[model samples]
Every structure is written in C-alpha cells, then in structure tokens.
Target: MIITLPTILSIIRLFAGFLILLGFLLLARPAADILAFVVFVSAAITDFIDGYIARKFNLVSELGKILDSIADKILVIMAWIIIITYYEFNSWIILPIGLIIFRELFISGLREYLASKSLSLQVTFIAKLKTTLQMVTISLTFFSGIIVDGSGSLTTFLLQPVAGSGTTLMEMACIVLIWLSAIQTIYSGWEYFKTALGLMGTKNDG
Candidate 1:
C-alpha cells in the first residue's frame, strides 16, 4: 500500500484514539476528563485535515478509504465508551448511546455487504452533520465532567461559567444533542440499507 500523507494521518488518528483511551484510564478525575477532551478534539481536527487533503490532492485510495473509516469508528466509539462510563447512570444518556452503537454496527454490516459486491455507500450530508453533533456533544460532556463536582480553584478559574450550575446545563445540552444525533444516525443508516437493498435486488419490484 502507498504511504500517502492522508493514509499516514488516518493511521495517526487510530493511534490517537488509543492515546485518548489511555488518558481516560491512567489520568485522575478532572485531569483524565480534560486530557480525553483535548486529545479527542485534536484527533477530530486531524480527521478533517486528512479528508480535505485526500480530496484536494487526489490522494484518495482504497486503502485510505478503509483505514479512514476504521479510524473514525475507533475514535468516535471510544469517546462514546468514555461518556457512558463517566456519565451518571440515566436513561437519557443510556438510550442514546445504545441507539448510536446499534446504528454504527448495523451500518457497518451494510457497508460490508456492499463491499462484497464491489460497491460503496455515499455518505450523506446529514451523516456529516450527525458526526459534528456527536463530536461536539462528546466534547461538551467531557468538559462538563471536569467541572461537575467542582474541580477546585484552578479548574473553576479556567472554566469560570462552566462551573457551578453551568455543568448541569452542559450535561443537559449534551444529552439532548446525543438524542438528536442518534435520530440522524438512524436516518442515515436506513438510507444506506435502502440503497443496499435496491442494489442487491432485494427490493420487491412493483
């Protein structure tokens, strides 16, 4: 496989996902949460950079496409795991998390089925919007945890308004957006399945 810049970036993104997971496991409370957010944000930035560079320079390749998709799934799913583990036990968070996971797995299977036929699914604009919402919600949720129970003077000073009741508001917003993103996720997944079904001749002809 060619070692293109975009491919290298996708590999880095995969590594960054592991680093973010390591940060969550090794670092202490507020610091762990903070580190995860910082690493995740950095990884998200690179995700965009790699895609743009690939499209602009025509560096897009089959390996790059597969690696990029795998990298994205790793990063976002890891973030969701962190969020589920850290957030307070509640149906609001749990339900959306479940939906998101289901969507990812189901759509992954759909994509694999298409791949077997030498076909690929086109990513919809709504799917991109869903990803942005998921990333923002995860970042905000991570930040919310850092200030949730009051991270003392330093964290408080840095977050100012993000402390006190601010954490609650952020948490609420995160939950709401998570739900919205899940809805979009299901819609996008359904679109993929519909396309796949039509292509596979599984759709009944009228």
Candidate 2:
C-alpha cells in the first residue's frame, strides 16, 4: 500500500504505544508521568483523526484496516497490561482489566471469521462510545496513578476528599469508569457475537 496521511498517523500511534510502555518502565522521575500523558493523549487523538481522514479521502485500504486495528490494540492493550502488572494482587482491578482484554480478543476473532466469508463487521455506535469511555478511563487512571505516586500538590487538590477517604476521589472515579467501560464492553461484544451468528446462519443457508 502507498504511504498515506492516515497510514502515517497509524504508524505514529504504534510508535507512541511503545513510547508509553518505555516511559512507564524506564523513566523513574515524576516528569516521566508528563511524558506518558503527552504521548498517550496524542496517540488517542490520532486514532480519531486517522479514521476521519481515511473515510473522507477514500484512502481506506486492506492495509489501513489492519494497521489501524493493530495500532489501537497496541496502545490500549499495552496500557492495560502495564496497569494490571502493578495491580496484579488487586482483584478489583484485575477483573475489569481481564474482561476488557478478553472482549477485544473475542471480537477480533469474530471479525476475522466474518472477513473470511467475505463479510465485514461494521463498528456500531455503542462500540464507539465504549472505546471513548475506555480511553478516558485509562487516561485518567494513568494520570492519577502517577500523581498519587509522586504525592504532589496537584494530587492533593484533585484527589483528596474533604472527608479524608482512604482512597482518593479521583482514584475512585477512575475505577468506577473502568468498571462501567468493562460492562459496556461485554454488551458490545455480545452485539458483535450476535452479528457473527447472523452472518454465519446466512452463509449456511446459501
């Protein structure tokens, strides 16, 4: 495939995901948090921009589809993997993270199966909403974890509750959103599975 703007953006996102993982691992200073945040948010923005450009310019190709999906999975899945590694002992965190990963893999396999039959699974509105919610939730969680780890004034102002709860309010909010996103993930996965079944039935009929 010829190099295009959207493909270039997707490549950038793929590199951004690597940078995020490296920042989280090798960068020990508090400033590393800022680096991670910048790279991650930039990548997230490109995700939307690439899709819009591809559709608008009629540049969507088979390679674009594969690269786009790979970039997205690398970004979000790697973020979740790193997060869960730190919180492996916490069941609450692990459960939602596991669910999100499983849903992605399941849907991907379903899509591949349909593609083999010359059918395509179009993204749904709910799936887009779920992706947005997940991106926001992951971003906040990453930011808060860094701030909390650093124990800076920003954390005090944003995370600290007046009542002095054990868990910071921001942390609580992130966890809640994670769970909400996971629930939506399951729902959307179900929808995809249903579509796959429908397609399978149609294929069998003919």
Candidate 3:
C-alpha cells in the first residue's frame, strides 16, 4: 500500500493528540501553558488539514477513516480530562463529559449494527459544528489557565491578576466559554442520538 498524503496527515493528528496529553503533564507555569496552547492549536489545525487533504487528494481509505475518528476522540477526551483535572472539580463538567462519552459509545454501537445490516450513515453538518465548538472550548480553557499561572497552586494567572489589572473579565470570559461548550456538547449529543435512532428505525424518547 502506498503511503498517501492523507494517511500521513492522519498520522500527524494522532501524534498531535499525544502531544496535547503530554502538554497537560508538563505544563506547570504560565510559560508551560503557553507551550500547551501551541501544542493544542497545532493539533486542531492538523485535524482540519488532514480531512481537507484526504478529500482533496482523493486518498480517503478505510484505515484513514478509522484512524481519524480514533484520533479525534482521543484528542477531545484527553483535553477534557486535562481541563477537569487542572481546574477545581465541578459537577458541571461531568454533564458534558458524560453526554459526550455516552453519545460516542452509542453511535459506535449503532454504526456496528447498521453495518451488519449493510447500511452506513453520513456525517452531518451539526456534528462538525459540535466538534468545532468542542475544540474551541478546550483550547480556550487550556489557555485560560496559562493566562493565570501560580506556583504549587491551582490558581492561574487570570485568577490572580497584577495590581491595577482586574482578572474578573478574563474569568467571566472563561466561564462563558465553558458554559457555551457544555450547551453545545449536549446539543450535539442529542443530534447524534436522533440521527442514529432514525437509522435504526427507532424514535427518540424524550
């Protein structure tokens, strides 16, 4: 099998996911957060580039599709884990995480069932929007910590501002993004579940 550009891009995305996870472990100070931000942004870029290249070059393969989905899930899940671990544990984050994990698992099972029936489902536009929001939320939350760095403490630079510089604004912005992400997360999961059920000839139960 020839090593195509799409395959190479998919490989890059997988590596980038590993880098994001590694960044979570190594980023201790504001500077470390900066580094993590770089890694995360790079990973996000690779996600888009890989998919674009795959279609542009007509190099989409079964292996590429499987690897791409795996990479995306790993990156999103790892980023969520890192953010929740870095911040004060809140039940709010659990809702989004739970919804995300449940939706993915349910969809995967549905896909398997459909495949057994010689059926396939197409990815939807809302799914793409959900993914974009997830990426943005994760990236911003990671950077929000970097904006406020504390040594041997959970407080980030944004939380502890310099004299004459208020950190309230930054905190509010981060909170907004986090909440927006949570909403989108639930919406996306619902959309996925609805579509999956439709495929299986089932109606979505309220």
What lDDT would each prediction earn against the true structure? 0.81, 0.84, 0.71
| Regions of candidate 2 where Cα sits further than 4 Å from its true position | 85-88, 149-154, 161-165
Best-matching candidate per TM-score: 2
Ranking by lDDT: 2, 1, 3
lDDT of 3 by residue, 42-67 (tens): 88888898889888879899888888
CA deviation > 4 Å runs, candidate 3: 149-167, 202-206
**Winner of 1 and 3 under lDDT:** 1
For all predictions, the C-alpha RMSD in Å is: 3.8, 2.1, 5.4
lDDT of 2 by residue, 44-134 (tens): 9999999999999898987778989989988898888776755545799899989999999888888888888898888999999989998
What's the best-to-worst order under TM-score? 2, 1, 3
TM-scores of the candidates in the order shown:
0.86, 0.91, 0.80
Question: In model 1, which regions exceed 4 Å deviation?
Answer: 149-167, 202-206
What is the Cα-based TM-score of model 1?
0.86
For 136-158, candidate 1 gives per-residue lDDT tens digits of: 88887787777766767754554
